[model samples]
Target: MFTQRSRCLLLIFLLYFVNKISSKVEFTNIKCNTFDPDFASFEYCFLKSVNRTYKYLSIKVNLHKTPITKVKVNIAIFKRYNGYKPFLYNITKDACKFLLLKNPDPVSNYIYNGFKSFTNMNHTCPFEVSPQKLPIGYINQQVTDVLPVPHGDYLFHSNWMAYDIKRATVNVYFTIS
Candidate 1:
């Protein structure tokens, strides 16, 4: 029989591998870039594309709450040709990450944005799965909201710390098509 510590270690190892295998990488639309002057103060904003084939925006959550209750998310999108046309998509929290509140209220006073790559290099392209080192700009966000990315571009905003979660990393994987 395995010892308690051994079992715990095994569980942790399994969870780590499971998280990696399950994580999906989604490419961001570089053209639809926006700067959220309100939230992070000139922070870069990206509208990521999502679909059934390319679903799952993997985000890591660091939590201080013994058991997290729910996560809140804000979402926005951009029109392809409208020049910052405001669009929105509904995100469903994936069970792979954590459960979300049944009734999630939208957040104001914050604009969502992040890093996106239009080119894919064998070394570094997908922001989350790339083996190459990430530059100063490509950083992960805290507790994020979820939704099936629409056929267009979208922006997301959330505070992981709201649920007592902090210091987390998020990775989004794309399906090879």
Candidate 2:
């Protein structure tokens, strides 16, 4: 049903449209079947909850093997574990990624707010009362790290607080390996 000219134009349009989207890769099917956990919020532009820990938050990125060059992630604590407030403690910098590891003492920009300190996510030292300051909720490519984790339905909380707020957000950005 197409005239020669019309057919040519349609073909060109289709080719252009295909070409426009061919180079992008979206890993958006964020089901637990795709990730370790079956329950994750797909509200982020790109988000996945793969932990570096075998049992919990152990995630690995192949910065050396793929186009992903580098990654910078921050871990933030929340007012409550699963209820995101969207504003108050939304951390805009790197914090908890250091505490989640085995020996995250090298990262000077973090605090180990005790995991039990859910009411106050601000414990800079003593590393005991501050569970958020532990590396259990962190991921880093720095010198030697350990992926500490717990089992089943654990949400990684933020351990960093540069302001007077209580909510937090741990962010990771990478340039595909």
Candidate 3:
């Protein structure tokens, strides 16, 4: 404990650990499309940057038809290596049932936890239009804590379907560093 070399080594190790824990996830871009505008349409979807280190996601969807009885969502994540390739997760869930669960599947719960606080689609189905926008304020540390990946580029793709018909698709591009 008195040796200068040992102290230096310990300091270096602490710094590395701190940096690893403080790593952040940043939104690079977002793309959204509505296949059938009569059912639903995107009002706006984009990433906002306040500074080099601060960025947030903002998206809004207008539901033209109210009280959609049944809805399903398909989510897939990809990591970039030369080009985007499938990474860890690919799941499809019944939106209504998933939302009402007491404890959902681990993977779905992990992913949904990231945006649950920021979106309005919280309760079970019979979903209706919301006048306000869905602003996913920021990607917080809670999300990073559950992520089991190194620094890299990732894509989160989601397809929304209602009554067994494809309705919309959203692609979110982000980087963890």
Q: What C-alpha RMSD separates each model from the true structure?
A: 16.9, 20.6, 5.6
Q: What value does the lDDT take at residue 140 in candidate 3? A: 45
Q: What are the clashing pairs of model 3?
A: none
Which scores greater on TM-score, model 1 or model 3? 3
TM-score-superior candidate, 2 or 3 = 3
Q: Least accurate stretch of 10 residues (summed lDDT) in model 2?
A: 24-33
Candidate 3 residue lDDT tens string, 1-177: 469999999999996886677456777788999999999988888777766756677778988887798999999999999999998999999989998899999899988877777677778888742223223334547545555466799999999999999999999998877
Residues 115-175 of candidate 2: C-alpha lDDT, one tens digit per residue: 2233232433222111222232233221112222221122334332222332223332211
Can you write out model 1's per-residue Cα lDDT over 1-177, one digit (the tens) per residue?
Answer: 999999999999986765543222334523221132221121232333354443222222222232323333334434343544544543433221322234323432112213224222112111121122222123322112232232333333322222333322222222211
TM-score of each: 0.25, 0.22, 0.81
Looking at candidate 1, what is the lDDT of residue 38? 25
Q: Residue 79: error of model 3 in Å? A: 0.4
Query: Can you tell me which runs of candidate 3 are displaced by over 4 Å?
Result: 1-22, 128-140
* lDDT (Cα atoms) of all candidates against the true structure: 0.31, 0.30, 0.79
